[model samples]
Target: MSPAHSVLHAVFGYAQFRGPQEAIIEHVAAGGDALVLMPTGGGKSLCYQVPAIVRQRAGQGVAIVVSPLIALMHDQVGALHEAGVEAAFLNSTLDWQQTLDVERRLARGDITLLYAAPERVVTERFLGLLDDLHARGQLSLFAIDEAHCVSQWGHDFRPEYRQLTVLHQRYAGVPRIALTATADGLTRADIATGLQLQDARQFVSSFDRPNIRYRIEEKKQPLEQLLRFIEREHAGDAGVVYCQSRKRVEELAQGLQDAGVNALPYHAGLPADMRQQHQDRFLREDGVVMVATIAFGMGIDKPDVRFVAHVDMPKNIEGYYQETGRAGRDGLPADAWMVYGLQDVVNQRRMIEGGDAAEEFKAVLRGKLDALLALAEATDCRRVRLLRYFGEESKPCGNCDNCLNPPAVWDGTDAARKLLSTIYRIQQQDAGLTFGLGHLMDVVRGQETDKVRQFGHQQLSTFGLGAPYSEAQLRAVARQLLALGAIGVQRVTTEAGHAFDTLTLTAASRPVLRGEQAVLLREATAQARGKKTRRAGALPVAAADLGPDAQVRFINLKAWRAEVARAHNLPAYVIFHDATLAAIAQQHPQSIAELEGINGMGTKKLEAYGADVLRVVGL
Candidate 1:
């Protein structure tokens, strides 16, 4: 049998490889490099892990994994140890004694996987030690996690990642694999070039995350909306509530706790130990919610997270996708709820324009935001829109709000054109969203608002033409334009009442007809009405649905899993995935022999729990 398959069975207790895992492992085990792009939760780890174990068995050497997040390193090492793999990590969080102990283990060739962040990896001390290990044939492979960070244009760009090429040049014989969950075509190309993977095999999995249900809501009373969403959708489940501001994160966490939800706040502003403790609790305890800014939740791997809600719009869709991808890793139903508003668009724009990101990057970021706004304002299936964005063609999912209950959509095509023209004029004059709104009204109704007269916008022929619609209606039209990428928000404000907090339009705006454009502004409004449209209710299903039989089974399984998990402090799935339970239910295996027939259960699992599983099922 292949060494890779043998370890997959003995250690991971899986009877088979998932998707391209086996092929990728084979390639690396045979001394070839690879660049892998798999969706979040799509078993990216196995691509490197299985090969690392197999290569080690061949007496090659230890694998060094470069990870970006320290938290992820801890989690991965814990998981590997639970599976009987000797893994260690070096990071700032490690004490000198602990670091020295790990180095000793590495020198003795006892560790299979050693994780280090890119920044610490090329240090003078580390490089010298790594050279010593290489001389003794103790350096097997190099795996870079979150490879997208190497691309400056990527959302999570890190300067340290750019220097990772040092490992490739210095350790030319070590096969390498770079892994990430999200990246566009451009970012992927950049990573390949930066990492010097000119001859490496590239594995690009479908970017679609079918398990995540994408959702966006127009911002109203955001706090109240978030509260209602939590109460209705997640009665007894763990989740992450994200806010753009540290203050908002703290307030929301406090409010959630007051509302009877188990929640804690985490942000960069918190004392280091406080943040760490909160993170630990959230990781170890069930139903502990975390309220955090984008500062938290990069490489968290909690599988049963029931949902992710955004109190404010993220900077771009990449950030949104990566954050919401944290939910439902257990392959169960999970919600991605977000509340967006005009102010959110302005705030996001302010952040983007204020940053040092390049103009090209900013343009791309703006396009991504516009797409998100379109998803939020979509009157059709939310899932459809989201999948389409990732370059997938799918029918309505029939699960999201827009599918079960679509919103009223008004045409407002002419109104849309007029709004774009107003924004364009404002852009030409170097004004922002706040001023654009006033300028638009002046052109639509011939209204002589003082600013309009001073700006001489009232003289425009499009002026007074859209007077038929209310100011609110005009703003809605403008929003759709921005969402659709017809106009870009030029400036933004975050200090509580400046105009430009949300989205701005770019060059994608459709040109307006000066004489003919006025003709369309007066047309009938298109209504995107909600179908079933009742506000979301408390947990879609009652806890009582966990029937007596199911409850007993679930309890026994959870207890068994919990005991194993706590013994090693690794997440339960690292021991036996939940998918095994559903399979057990369907088969109701009556004996050790029967349990062995289950898809994921291997000889190791059979020998360990074969009798217990049979007895629990009343066989």
Candidate 2:
């Protein structure tokens, strides 16, 4: 049998190949290594799986998969089993009997794929087993999922991953493939070096997810703002609400529940079963809201999440982008919202600095956080700012809050000068943050404070210089300055408790002369546009590629997707990812090969419904 036919028939029970899957499988089966950076809902799994099947058919041993998350390993194994593929995982969660059984299966050449943690693969026992498998010619290739974790500098670093390089030295002949959904240019280089995959062919897909509408709101009455947002944008959609603290997650979840929302809390602090229960409910139930800390969504495969709301600011822009990317996997419309405040920035900075990470790493993290701050305080297009951070140029998406409700601009140069001078005079010897902008503005407006009198700050010429504005307007100006790099927020919550603090001037803010009259200017430049809304390579498809029947089938598949999405309370793609439906439409297959030609149609799926798809297209 041909390698392609054998691959479809033996492990996956399909007759054709999917988008880029055939080429990737062909390359890997021929012993070439690869690096695939596809979107979350993209069929990254099949790129390795099909090749593993082909290798096994060619008398190779089991394909070794290095996965970071133990739960993700179990999920892959379950899916493989349903497809009739021989796969098993060895991890800390496995019992002694299960471990022995997996080892025995590997020795007998009964398993085509063996998934293990990077930690376990380097162990003496696993090495010995691997040696035996190699002797019997049972070893196929090494597939590394979430390969970005190998970088100690990455957000999801795993020190154990460094040991994976040993797999190359020990098993020199076997090919390898590394895959991940998220990585910046720096992180991408780091991963290639860290994993010693310098020679691997890289497959970098576009990072844009136009289905998700990016939105950020200033944390003014955050709770009320969140309530209004939820009511308007996602009244009955399944979504995730992310909080920075476990306590806040619980509180917000309970509050949402009390207010008649179907919300549940999930975090690492909770018991394992409870967390699992919440996750399972989120995956299975329609319209369930999972209120969670950052711990909840890593390696999670839920695709149809309609909204991702951040109750607090994320640590960095990368973290925010990755977290929000989880929504709208099926190429459907979704929302990404956050309520941010200055305190959130201060707290996150402290957290990053106080951690055991190196100073250089902290500096990198700080720059990323500052970029996110710019997005929040930006009066321009939210989508434009978000895309620009990822190195993509975009026009302003006129749909976001700032675009719809443009902030009124007033000449605040003189006002900013006054605040800067007051801050400089009060904390002359000591540079610190005294209070929130409102209270500071109150003091500046000549409102008597016993503390101000004790310090005698009301006597300064800058004090009460700009009393025409309300406290809110003053606070807004201070925030704008901070965003514009005209002022620096003092890192208030130090190792010491909040006894006394005040805003300090930075070199960036020193240029605003206190008494100089300033002009009010608002200019929207190179306007950020709405997301580039199109299917993957939509423009590249030939006019002849989609015929009348194919077009009809595509519409029907989308209809089915929408129905399933509504019924399952999932984002449409979570039910049947866009790539999968698109593949079905593109290949009006009359037989299994034509069906299998579409990516993501593994053996089990093809065996079960290959004829159904062909029949639907009346082929």
Candidate 3:
């Protein structure tokens, strides 16, 4: 048998490889390089991990994995050890003595996978260790996880990753594999260019996470909306609540906690220990609700996370996808719910324009944000639009908010053109000076505010042309224009030393204004009729619908899992994932022989826990 398949069964406790994992492992194990673009929970780790173990078992050398997330490193190493794989990690969490011991193990060829943070790597001392290993012919491979971090255009770009180019330079002959969960075509190309992996065989997996149910709501009492979602759909389940600001994170966490939800806050503003503890508890315990900024959740691998709720809009689609991808890792039913308002759009625009990034980077960021806004305002199936962003096509998912309860949409083509024309008209009226959305909307809605009169925008022909719509309607129109990329916001400072936004028309706007493009906006009235088109008490759990016998079996298996987890001091899902338990309960595997045929049950796991699982199934 191939060593890779042997390890896959004996160690990971899996019967087979998913998708391209086996092929990628074979290629990389044969000393070839690969670039893998798989979605979250798509068994990416196996591609490198199986090869790492295979090469080590073959007496080649130890594999060095460069990771960006320290917390994730800890979790992965623990899981590997449970699988009887020799794995260790080097990061700040380890003391000097512990670090020394890990290095010793790696050098002695006792460790199959040695995980290190990118910053810990590329150091002189680490390089020296690698050099020693290379001299001893004990270096198996170099694996760069989260390879998108190397791309400066990526949302989670880490400068430390750019220096990873040193790996190729130093270990010229070593086979390397780089993997990431989310990256667009441009970001993918940039990842290849930055990591110098342009020649590596690119294995791009489908970006579809079919298990997650996507839903977006226009913000109306966002906290209450989030509460309704949590209480009505996912109460007592593991979930993540993403906010846009540290302050908002704290407030929402406290609010959720006060509302009887087991919520906690995590952000860069909190003490390091506090942040770490919060993350640990969220990982190790069930029923935890983590309210955090984008600072959290890069490589979190908790498989049973039931939902991910965004209290505010993420800056871009990449960020949104990465954040939402954290849910439903167990491939069970999960929800990706979000509530975004006009303020969220404006705030994101200000952040993009007022930030310190280069023009090229900002331009890329704008495209991503615009795409996200389009998704938010989409009248069709959200899944189709989201997949299209990643260059994939599919039929309506029929499970997303749009599919189940379609939002009312209005033709905003004329409103969009008016908004874009207002920007162009203001530019002409003020000798190329432009105003922000507020001023432009004020003039369009015919609100003779002080800024409008002072700027003489009231005199423009476009002024008062949009008087048919109310102020709120005008605001909605402006947001749709920005979302559609018809209008863009820019940073501007006036002579009086006041900082404000300047509106600009995009290339996408010209066609819309010339009566060549159609625009659809979610009707503003939908927010008022929220949750009315559908009848729902709670989001349906995937396994909740099992028949009475299977249901009882599932409960019994879950109870056994809990007892085992408590005794082992591990998370319940870690002992056996929900999906695995569901399979066992449904099939009623009454003996070790029958259980051995289960997908997630490995030889080691079956030998250790198979009897217990069978007993729970009434053997």
Candidate 4:
């Protein structure tokens, strides 16, 4: 076998290349630079891993992988070690002795892959190591993971990633491959230019993860709805629940656990050891639910996560895609379920506008958030809208909530004008001292409560003009207007020194509130929401399609995987992914010959696991 194919089947457990893997590997191993854009869980690791092994075997030195995710780096090294590949990582988790050992291994050419964070890679000491390797002609390539972070326009912008351009500047001779799971055309171009990979071979794979069914729900009762969805669909499956804040993560995890969901909270505020433990348990155990803020998920390599539930919507498509991609990595059916209320929108908007990021960065963030809003308020298929954002086109998925239960389009022109007018009126009354959503909603919906009475809000011309709409309906219109840029949210400190959110009218508000522009918003009609409940059970529906014998084999395989993983101190999916086991069960192979043909079964895995798999399949 060629080096690529030899390393492919011998180290990694794969019988064939999927999508653009083979071609990309061949090009990179032949000393070509590559810019690969594959979706999350699209087997991106192999493009570099296989090539890294191939080049090393050909007498080239270690491939330097720059990754931002330390936990994920450690996991990748562990998985590679299980495959008997020579890999090590230099991140904060390593002690000085361990770091020196890894550096020594690289120096001796005993390591084929050395993973380091972008921050560590650009340090003076690390640069000296690279200089040494370059002098000896031992450098194989530079692999930049999550390359989009280098782009200012990308959501997860890291300043350290910008310094990575020095890789091309300093080591101009060595080939480089910049890979990312999510990036639009603009972000992609920025990455290419920023990393000096403009002339590299670009491989843009399909962004579709077909096994993941996308679903978005208008939030009515978020925690309750989340509980129902979890109990009904993913009761005993590995999953992730993302919230918008640390406080919310803690509350949601407490609520889920109180409701018997076996959920744990993870955020940056927690002690490092505790956070690491939560992450470790989420990875190692079966059916563990990780409730986290954005801090939790970038590098998670768990493959059997049955679902990713966003209790609060993400800031943008890149974030949403990256977060949701944490699920169903094994190629089984996974659900990307989210519930976004008007409050979620307003909260996210407040974060953007009040944040300390640069103005240009904030503008880009708003555009991305608007794209996410479009997805949330979509009347068309959610999958089509999502794919279109990434510059891909596809027919309606016929599986998303929009396809199964299309939401209603209510003309909110009058409601928007009323709400905008209310923001305008509230500001005028207090000499630009604005009020929050509750007060604004109270004034708009004709509530004669004590606060409304105390503030004399009922005297405003826009007051009670929105009586035709409920508080929820008016809030929805306000949220859409915020997204439309017709209005904005301003963070304020009251006289008592407590901070609060207030609605403010933007320049864009003039055109819409004056009846110059018509407004349309998605309203979750009672019937549509009812139908959504019926259609929301997609996972169970997919799982039940497996035959009885196949189901039994799946159960057996899962049990065996859990036991073996526990014994080896590894994740169950790392032993054998659910999709791989399903394939095994479907094939019902009676011998090692048949097991060798399985997709994830390479020489190392086949040698290490072939017999156990056959036994579980009752062969």
- For model 3, residues 1-619, the per-residue Cα lDDT tens digits are 7898888887877878899898899999999999999999999988999999889888889999999888878778877766778899999978999989988887788888999988978999999999999888889999999998998878888999999999899989989999999999999999999989989999988889999999888787988888878776677888999998899999999899899888999999999999988988897776799999988998888887889999899888888898999999878878899988888887898898888989988888888888998888888999999889889999999999889877777777777777788788878767546566778778777889999889877887887888877676667777787777677777777788877768788787888999798876666655323332212222225456677898788878877887877787666666777777888878887678888877778776887788778777893
lDDT of 1: 0.75
Error of 1 at 322 (Å): 1.2
Best candidate per TM-score, number? 4
lDDT of the candidates, in the order given? 0.75, 0.72, 0.84, 0.85
Model 3: lowest-lDDT 10 consecutive positions: 531-540
lDDT of 4: 0.85
After TM-score superposition, the amount by which residue 303's alpha carbon in candidate 4 deviates from its true location, in angstroms, is: 1.4
lDDT of 1 at 288: 82
Query: What residue runs in model 2 are displaced by over 4 Å at the alpha carbon?
Result: 1-26, 353-357, 394-411, 429-438, 484-486, 489-502, 512-603, 606-619
Question: Candidate 1, which segments miss by more than 4 Å at Cα?
Answer: 379-388, 417-472, 484-488, 491-510, 513-547, 572-576, 581-619
Tell how far residue 27 is off in model 3, in angstroms: 0.9
Q: List the residue pairs that clash in candidate 4.
A: none
Candidate whose lDDT is highest: 4
**RMSD after Cα superposition, model 1:** 4.9
Off by over 4 Å in 4: 494-496, 526-554, 611-619
* Better-scoring candidate (lDDT), 3 or 4: 4
Give the 10-residue window scoring lowest on summed lDDT in candidate 1. Answer: 518-527
Ranking by TM-score: 4, 3, 1, 2
Worst 10 residues of 4 by lDDT: 530-539
